[model samples]
Target: MTVRVRLFAGAAEAIGQDEVTLADVTTLGDLVARLVADFGSGVAPVLDRCSFLVDGVRAADAETRVTGTVDVLPPFAGG
Candidate 1:
């Protein structure tokens, strides 16, 4: 199966793409590891700071099963 990841803010800039498709990634941890492997270590920090939305719902933890679309959103700043 394939999972689609949508990056936002720093996460998008770090990977140089707003969206990517990954294979063989069944959980959030797997997806994060794959991204770091594919995109290089530079993306790790961004991923660390990101909050994930799995198919439009906030992921509870790294073990969260992932499918469909995953949205990677970095912390936002506003006042």
Candidate 2:
């Protein structure tokens, strides 16, 4: 399964992209682990300050399954 992660604000700056695609993701935790592994410490802090949105809905669980685009929204990035 391909999961799309949309990064905003500092998260996007850390990754240097607005979006990223991950493969074979079963849960949101899986994606986070993969990201930590892939980006090392660079992305950790950014991720910590952000929240996850799964298909436009707020994600409350790290164990939430990835069904569509996962938006990584930083605090007040909408502004």
Winning model by TM-score: 1
Please report, as a residue range, the 10-residue window in candidate 1 with the lowest summed lDDT. Answer: 1-10
lDDT agreement of model 1 with the native: 0.96
Writing each residue's lDDT as its tens digit, candidate 2 over 1-79 gives: 9998989888889888898999998888898888888878778888887899999998888889887799998888335
How big is the positional error of residue 79 in model 1, measured in Å on the Cα after superposition? Answer: 3.5
Clashes of 2: 0
- Model 1 stretches astray by more than 4 angstroms: none
Compose the digit string of candidate 1's lDDT tens values, residues 1-79.
7999999989999999999999999999999999999999999998999999999999999999999999999999998
Give the CA lDDT, 0 to 100, for residue 53 in model 1.
98
TM-score to native of every candidate shown: 0.97, 0.89
Q: Pick the candidate with the highest lDDT.
A: 1
Task: Give me the displacement of residue 56 in model 1, in angstroms.
Answer: 0.6
